[model samples]
Target: MTDALAIATDLMPVLARHAAAADAGAAFPHDSVRALREAGLFGLLVPAEYGGMDGDLADLVDVAAVLAGGCLSTAMIWAMHCQQVDAVVRHAGERLRSDLLPRIAQEGYYLASVTTEPSKGGHLLTASSALLPEDDDLLVRRDAPIVTGGEHADGFLITMRAGPDAAPSDVSLVHLHRDQVEAQVVRDWNAMGMRGTRSVGMTLSGVAASHQVIGQPGGFRAIAVDSMIPAGHLAWSACWLGTARGALDAVVALIRSRHVPSSMSRDSELLRQRLARARIDIELAGGYLALVRDEVLRRRHSGQPLDDRSLQIRIDTVKVACSELTFSAVDRLVQLGGAMIGYQRDAAVPLERHFRDLRSASLNYSNDRLVGAIGTMTLLDGAGRLP
Candidate 1:
């Protein structure tokens, strides 16, 4: 196994042990996060020169899948953290990169993304909050409807209008340490699933050094297109697939451990068929994830533009497909396990939790919106035979 995957594998028991308590209390998985930090998994993507492993997308996929099998909430928080890390690595200026990347590598500084604004709904490409000049520093005050793991993050990567006069689409990404920002929790997070994420609403006011702006001002569009979308989608897909796989494993184990009644041989055969179907769905989702990962890696290595139409479609489709397919797989496993076993809160198998967590998969990004966007892109590609 790869070092990253091995590290995540070793932390599964710790994650599983705390998963139920964290979910019950809607608390952040502090122990799980501590274990990951101690294992140095936070530096899995940092460059080697910065004392990191410089792992690739495949490594992320493997690690997320393994981690999610233990606790989907913890795995998702890790994935989101990695997404912000990638942004900093790819777009941060020299000063910011030198200051933060090393600290992230050595100290495991957790980072969070602040993109969704109060009035903008789910739109992430534009920002209503503007960065105003304050002497030598840039000042920004913004309110987000939801900031995942906001309370636990050591730093934030915020999105804002490039300047007071800039258009909504002229956005910039700014980094601020927790000490640099005055933040207030505006709303508590009491969600149906993925409770450990603690994605609460917050208002933040911060002054960032001019050098903290990632890439050029008004250049966030490129950053999102090239790095953010791909990283977030792939990592989330892996997590969802892992959750479904974990549920399947749990149910299968429960079945094997119990003695089957000979009188119900026909029903037993049907259950086996359903399990086989669930396995096939999981396999198909995993296969597609691997294909997308390889394609993304190939493009990055070849220095090809990631914004190409064909690849963009594939990236978006992978997220939608994996989210739907994995949820379906878990749903099948839940039904196969039946109400007495799967629906029980304290059952041997944790299918209830898996079912609830996977329910958010489609709504997280809204598969309807993605499908519509994909359709528009497809219509725009008049020369498209196949991608």
Candidate 2:
């Protein structure tokens, strides 16, 4: 925790410098991103073979929470970077894994989620992007609606669906170099919160694909079901927990700096109850994430299946629990913070961006839907007609 705190504290000045500009400019966190790269924070999950921390899930959560405490948008961007790294570790070629990962660890390359679409939306689904076969190469055309750090990422783990027209081409993950692929921003993203993340809509045209994939194309069912979504959900638990911590930090600072309003901050019992409840919820949320993450580590090392019915259940539970708790914490912090919280330009107000970035959780994993499926899978002894 102290190491995570120290790393976060060192990054605060840099993060603060860009937090407002990014929010106001509706631009990417380029400066803070560069600092993250220089700090070697991007390789937190890269395997030790590639000079990465090969950091456990716990470490990932800690770092995410720390940064989310400072700026949720930046933290999510970093989380996306870790997600990209995770894909390679789970599925990329030996050449890519060997050559690219080391540079990611040492030099710090940018990683982004080139997923998320409105029409054939497959934020985590492989059966959504449109793919066209052209001779030996496949032409992948993707229209992502909310791709985080789309313009800034050095590379993207883009998802494309095999359209009904193409040969039964396999659906899988492909790496897109910024220079090689045509990533044109289709829409401006001026979301009220998490604006700094630059989660813009993008269209990928005429992107050529190589043989290196994140599992066999048609075999993406395994990658998404068994690996990608679950890993992403677990990683987000850490990120939202960080947002909760950051929100709490914001309230504390506000209390210290502002004159407490007598209506709520001073002598109101209801307000006090709400604040107390928020505190309990955030702590409980954090604990849930920590416990599940520890379980993940234990299972990973021991080569044992999770005690939970499917690995997805625990992942879903943690995501739902933390996402709800963090959002509540942010709201309560603003309540306790009064009008000052609404002033986005102020450096001290943490609620604005935290509010926006935390929203990505449910959309990415959707624990509510996962729970029903988990119940059927566990009690019925088989995954049912739910998907």
Candidate 3:
């Protein structure tokens, strides 16, 4: 077993115990974060030389799924952190790597991404921030629309235009420490789901050295297409599946304990059917997830990034299917569970919380937008024979 999976397994029970409280209070899962940091989970994607696990895609998926089964918020935080970690590991310069990766692995420094901007109008590709020449360093000024766990993150991968004269595509991903960037929480994170993510809007202004930006100018587009989409899509899908599995586990336990046959109202054979459907849905989703995961690992081992449109389409399909199927499983399990599933006070069931968290999957990037993108791709390319 990978260190990520092993450590995550040990953290699951503790995370589950506090998940309800985290949701109820709409607070960051600080305790869970602490445990993860201590376990070196924050550096799961960093290299072994940097004191990391040097874990593969399967390891990332396994750890994410396991954490999601216990707490969606914590799982998401981990996923976001891993995404940034991937960027740093794959694109960052030697100086930045030497300065940051080791500390991230040993000091428990959490990282978050700052890609979306208020002025960009929700298009993640466009950067609203301008990088200005200030002697040896650059001055970054812009407001990010949302920064999940921003308050707690030690730093952020701030996406911005390379310079004032740069084109829209000439963007850079800069890593700025908290002391360097001023994060003003512009909007409170009182959302209907994923409350523990603490995804608040923040106005940012910072200064970064030239080396802080990963890769060369205009390289962010490549990074987004190659690393960001695949990692984010796969990890998020696995986490969603984990949440569904947790709900299904609760439903199964409840049914096994009280599902008596005969004239009992809740003991219909249809109840078993509902449970079976939930299981099958999760299984089907898991199978697809595993297939795609294997492909991701294969390509990684081959030193080829998943940059092709066909692979991207496949990744999007996996994300959409896993999101829908997990939501379906949780919804079905809740319906079969009846009134007890609605109990707000019980942390053991977590049915209602699961429902709320699962709802965000479709809205994460809008399944509608992906469907449109896919349809346009199919129309243009003919969807003819993918390897």
Which candidate do you rate higher for TM-score, 1 or 2? 1
Provide the TM-score for each candidate, comma-separated: 0.96, 0.86, 0.94
Off by over 4 Å in 2: 1-5, 162-170, 206-209, 256-268, 305-310, 339-348, 356-361, 364-387
What is the per-residue lDDT of model 3 for residues 1-387, given as tens digits with 9 covering 90 to 100? 766788899999888887887888989999988989999998888889988888867888899999999999999999989988888888899999998899888987889988877666545566756799899999988787778999899999988988999887688888899999887998889888898999988988889999998988657888887677778888999999999988888766655666532322445888778888999999988998998888878888898978776777788888899999999998887677566654354634778889899999998877887888788777766765645
The candidate that wins on TM-score is 1
Find the 10 residues in a row with the least total lDDT in model 1.
258-267
Candidates 2 and 3 compared by lDDT, better number: 3
**Candidate 3: lDDT over CA atoms?**
0.84
Please give, for residues 217-325, the per-residue lDDT of candidate 1 as tens digits: 9999999988899999999999999888888887776676654324223357888888889999999899989988898889888988799887888898899999989
User: lDDT of candidate 1?
Assistant: 0.88
Clashing residue pairs found in predicted model 3: none
Comparing 2 and 3 on TM-score, the stronger one: 3
Sorted by lDDT, highest first, which candidate order results? Answer: 1, 3, 2
| 1 against 3, candidate with superior TM-score | 1
